[model samples]
Target: MAALAWLLIPLFAAIGAGLWGSWANRNRKTAGDGIELAGYTRFREAMEKPDAVVEPEPHSGG
Candidate 1:
């Protein structure tokens, strides 16, 4: 019983720490917001452009 309690104490503490960190970081602003917004506008414009050819990259033989 004592051994099981010792194992579970650290496990529960780790879980609690992870949950706290995630909650703290939930409201932060990310760096790519402006880039994403610009990309969205460009995508909308591309939809209206007739000559846009979406090309798939040739896969390099990994």
Candidate 2:
């Protein structure tokens, strides 16, 4: 019974630590803020600039 209790103490501690870490990071924001708006702005700018070639297909056939 003593050996079983010793083993379970560390197992429970590890489970508690994992739960705490996940809860701590729940509200964090990533680096891609305003990404959609920025992409649209760049696309519009590329269309307006005459020197830039807005190719119909940017990717070549593999």
TM-score for all models, in order of appearance = 0.43, 0.43
- Note each model's CA RMSD in angstroms: 10.8, 8.7
Over the stretch 6-45, how does candidate 2's per-residue lDDT look in tens digits? 9999999999999999999798777775998899999999
State each model's CA lDDT, in order.
0.92, 0.89
Best model number under lDDT: 1
Per-prediction backbone clash count: 0, 0
For candidate 2, the TM-score is: 0.43
Model 1: per-residue Cα lDDT at residue 7: 100
Candidate 2: lDDT over CA atoms?
Answer: 0.89
Error of 2 at 11 (Å): 0.4
Off by over 4 Å in 1: 28-62
